[model samples]
Each structure stands twice: as C-alpha cells, then as structure tokens.
Target: MEKVQVSPSRTGSHDQSHNAKWGIAAGFSASLVGIGLARFAYTPLLPAIIDAGWFDASKAAYLGAANLAGYLLGALTGRVMAQRSSTAFTLRAMMLLASVAFFACAFPVSYLWFFVWRLLSGISGGALMVLAAPAVLAYVPPSKRGLSGGIIFMGVGVGIAASGTLVPLLLQQGLKQTWLGLGIISLVFTAIAWKGWPKQDAAPVHAVQHPRQSNNTTLKALYAEYALNAAGWVPHMIFLVAFIAHGLGQGLEVGAQYWVLFGIGATLGPLLAGVLADRVGFGLALRLSFILEGVCVCIPALGLGTPWLMASSVVVGAFVTGTVPLVLGRVQELLVHHPAQQNAAWRTATVGFALFQAVAAYGFSYLFSYSGGNYALLFLLGTGAIALALLIDIVASRSVDEAAPR
Candidate 1:
C-alpha cells in the first residue's frame, strides 16, 4: 500500500470545520439553558408557585420582575466578564450558575431566597444571550453564519417548548421535583456543552482602529425601536401562562398546552423571519412583524375564544422571537462597512432591550396588582407599545431614505 500525505492547509481547514460544528452546538446549548430554561421555564411555573401558596400573586409577580432586573445588569456586564476572564469561561460559569439557581429555587426557603435565585438565573441567561452566538459565529464561515445563528437561537424556542410540555408532567411529580427536574436537565446540557466552545475566543474589538461613529440618527431610532419591542413583549413573556391559568379560569394543564403552542411558534420564528428578511429586506420584515405581533397580542384583550387565543399564542410567540433576527439584520444593514460600529450599535440595542424589559416587568407587575389582576389592560398596553414602535420605524425609515443620496 502506498502512503498518502495530507497538506497542512487541507488539514487545518478540516480542523476548523470540525471545531465550528462543535462551537455551534455549544452556542445552542448555552441559549437552551440560559434563556430557555432560566427565564422562560419560570413563566409556566409562575402560576404553580402562586397556587402552591409559596407566594401571593403580587409577590410572585414581583419575583418575576426580579429576573428582569438582573437581566439588565447582566447584559451591561457580560462583555466585561468575557474581557476579564474569557468568553468560554464566562459562558460555562453562567450555565453552571443557571443550573444552581434552579436547584436553589426548588426549596422556596423564603421569598428572599427564591428572588435571589431567580435573579441569578436571569443574570446567567442575559450573559449567555450576549456571549454565546458571537463566540460561535466567529469561527463559522461567513456563508453559513446566518443559518448557524438561527440554529443557535432556536435553543430558546426549544427550551420554551420543553417547559410547556415537560413542566406540566414534572409538576405532577410535585413542585419541588419539577425544579429538580429542570436543574437536572440544565446540568446535563452544561456538561454536554462544556468542551464544545471554540478553543479561541473571538478577537477583541480594537476601538482605536475601527472608529465607532456612523449613522447616529438611524442607530438612535433602532435603539428606541428595540427597547419598545422589548417592552411590548413583556406581557406574553411573564403573564401569558398565569393569565390563561388563573385569569381565564383555565387549568394549569390547559395553560401549559397554550404555552406549548407558543413555544412551537417561537422555535420556528427566527428561521421564518430570516427568510422573510432575505426576501423583503429587514426593514420591511420588521415592520410587518410589528403589525402581526400587535394584532396577535391584542386578541386576548378583545375577549376572543380558544381559536383566537391559540392564534395569539402562536403568532405573538413567533414575532416575539422572530423580531430578534430582523433587528440584528437591520443593524448590519445600517452599519455595513463599520464592524466596530455595528457591534456597538448591537450592544446598545441589547442594553436598551434589557433596560426596557426590566422597567416594563416592574411597571406591569405594579399595574397588575393595582388593577386587581387586569390581564386585559396589560395586553392592551403591550399592543400600544408595539404600535408605537411601528410608528417610529415608519417615520425613521422615511427620514433615512430622504437623507440618502439619490
């Protein structure tokens, strides 16, 4: 037999390709554990926690707001943590923290204990959301980045779907056991993703080389739009399950089933939105998403029946997650030549989203208590916010076009 030699370039390409696949897997796991399990699992669990007498409705709602508050902090600090330590180290640590938070939540030792753990879970989720995709995408070939990014973010939808399906079954085992089950699942994901991160983190941005100045007007509008979108989605994110379970007099199981539908929509949202953006342009896709989401979000407020509610769950779920890629794509379009500026714009958008989400959570929680659990009011308000965002985009797009050299 003749010996065959492989060239260095070919071998290096093979290794890079191998590592990129694992990196995408790690990114997916990070999102599944961080955002899916840490943040969304709590939505289904909210009504259960209240029903179990672990906390009164108002208190439990406020506890949900605590996670949003922590998310804001984590979004602001995630990059700093990566810079100080390393992206991989920070991602793994955050996943472990989220898993630990789930276990700690199982006890419900006190309101303070549960609040602290939930907040920690939110922190983990926010950090993972910030760091995971960029770390993985840095290694992926440019041609595949779009699809890879969609696959990674689909973890959130998967996590949401899992909560809708698995949480109900786990609840039957007992609430304590449900928490344990979630923790076990998160831990397994953590272990699986441990070695999947890229051997090298994405190269740090050097601001000195890449000046951050670019279309300021467009960037400001984007930040505002992203923040408003975050605010508008809070009702469904934190209260949909409770509203159905308690507000509509539907049982927990029925509410969980609706959540499953939402999860299914969420799982498909990003991919669908990406394809739409490719066809119609991100700006148009974004505006259309706003219109669809606003209508869906208002269905419950209109006192609609099961079919409408089902449509609401699925459409709102899809738009809620779908809007993400649209917004990111828009940012890329706005700052096409300025990579550093694009990153800065995205960080600003993310921070604005976290800030508005935290504010809306607390504001809505207070409103919910004040209105005597008026779920419809919250839905209307959410719809109003989305409408405002659409209005802003309409105005901003026109202005950007007029300012362009024809």
Candidate 2:
C-alpha cells in the first residue's frame, strides 16, 4: 500500500483554525479576570478593610449584597442590550465600565463609592458570564466541548486564585495603592482582550433558536434550579471573607486560604462535571453534581475545622460550581438543529437563563440577611437548596427521556 502525504495547504488551514479557536478561548478567559478577582478576593480582604478602618464589617456585607443585586439586574438586561448590539460590543462596553468602577476604588473610604463600584463590577461580571460561556461553547465541535468547557470555566478559578495570591501582596503596598493596582490590572487585561478578540461574520451555528414545544417547562425548571442554587451559594459568595475572618479569627493572610481552597475546588468542578455529562448524559450528571455539592455545603458546618475544612471547601467548590457547563451543553444540544431564525428561540432561552439567575441572586441575598451573619446557617441553607436542585434534575431528566424522538 502506498502512503499518501498530506498537503501543506491543508495543514496550514487546520493550524490556522486551531489558532483561531485558541485565541477565542483566551480572549473570553481574559475577560473574566476582573470579575473573578472581585468575587473571590473580598472574602480574604474583608478583615483588613475592616481593621484598617477602610469600611465597617456591615458595609462590606452591604456592598457584597449590592453587587449580587447588580449582577441579577445585569443578567436580566444583558440580552436586551445584546439585541441592540453584538456580544463583543456589549462585552467591551461592560469592560470599560468595570475598569472605571474598579479604578474608582482608589479612594478607599467612600461607602457610597464602594457600593457603586461593587454594583458596577457585578453588572460587568454577570454580563460576561451570561454571554461568554455560550459563545465559547459555540467555537468548538461537540466532540471536544467538554474539554473546551472546562478550559473556559477554569478562568473563574484562575482569577480567584490569582487574586487570593495577590491580595496579601497588595495589603503590604497599602490599601489605596493596592486597589489601584488591581484596578489597573483589570484595565490592562480588558484592553488586551478587546484588541486580540476575533470577529466572525457568522454567529455560532447553535446561536439561532430553540424548539417551540414545552419550553415553558424548561424555563420553569431552569428558574427553580437557578433560584435555589443562587439562594444556596450567593450568601456564601458575598460573605465568605467576613465569615472566615470572624469564624477562624485569622489574619487576612490566613483567611486567604479559604479563597485558595474555593478556587481550587471550583476549578476542578466544571471540568469533572463536563466530562461526566458527556459520558452519562446531562441530567444524571447534574443530579450527581447537586448531591456532591449538597454534601460539600454541609461538610464545612459539620464541625470540620482548619486544613480538613479547607479540603472539604475545595471538594465542595468543585461539584457545586461545575454543573453550569453541562446545563449550557444541554441547551445547546436542544437548539443546535433549530430553525434559520435561531436568534428568537436562543434569545428566549437566554433570557430565561438570565432571569432565573437574577431571581436566585435576589432570593439568596434575603436569605443571607436572615442568617444574621452565621456562616453555618448559610451553609445549611445551601444544603437544602442542593437537595431541591437535585430533585429538579431528576424530574427534568425524566421529561427529556419521555419527550425523546424514540
């Protein structure tokens, strides 16, 4: 048998597309840095901010809650704005706004200013999340989607972990300058992403539409799942830093460990779940994720202390957060073969996605407040939410199977 040699042109074309895909992934990941840092950094920095008289403990709490509120609002509003423009355009706008909001923190002591910036950051972050994942998913083939999804979500963990490492260094630089540095970093990253990000004349194939069947059911179930998860996790997101500070009586440096653990766990969660979903199907993967998360949420409160506690936090973080890609993948599978004007159906599902997340954020904020600053209570609430989410997964899975073309 004669062996055939591959042509240089074909090899070049393949290489070019590979490069393009990698570029898109990196651009999307870079866009997440500011939000990731903001979300995870404060948990460690809260203690220092309070002790240094930068702000009160209560003010930090309020700022976090406000940020989540803005995130909720941003989610509901992002696609409407996207309709007026492109996701890239919207992303650039949000990034510019986020940069300004972050840099505004240079003043350090203005309660109102902090609140404003936090909220703005939340909006930028939320919009990034709502738009980025789906876009990233679109660039790759179905066969490699699990790996691609993991790579995309890793940005969240990377940003969080980087901030954890950086916050302590910033503290040494002093508060005002530290925040200013972080703000500058955000600006630089955004500028780089804006310049390097690719523009395609065609949108992703799956971007078009969803089926007109019982989408209402999908929407309802999605809303409940998002709401419950948000309720379960948002409080922890906002207050984890403060909780660590007070609960462990550790200095800021030590408190950074929680974020370190959380980031590590969150990093692993999406990758593992994506693979599981690809293998076992989306619904069953989601159910397992929720169960793992439920256990993880409660583990921290089961009187596990210190290093063991950190281990649990990491474990919990992985499963708790990893379910997102699988969910998005399921939606993509449903909509991939839809009609020519796929934007309408896609928009409907996207909008539902945003609103569900918003409701979750809002409801969870209230739950956080009601917990009266008790971390254990917050975790308990998360545990319950996970249980409900698991139930939703089972029901939704059964529905899909029953509704199958068979």
Candidate with best TM-score: 1
Q: What TM-score does prediction 2 earn?
A: 0.84
Residue 297 displacement (Å), model 1: 0.8
For all predictions, the C-alpha RMSD in Å is: 2.0, 4.6
lDDT of 2 by residue, 288-315 (tens): 7677667767765677777666766687
User: Lowest lDDT 10-mer window, candidate 2?
Assistant: 339-348
What's the lDDT for candidate 2?
Answer: 0.65
lDDT tens readout by residue for model 1, 363-404: 999999999999999999999999999999889878988998
- Candidate 2 clashes: the total is 6
lDDT of each: 0.90, 0.65
Best by lDDT: 1
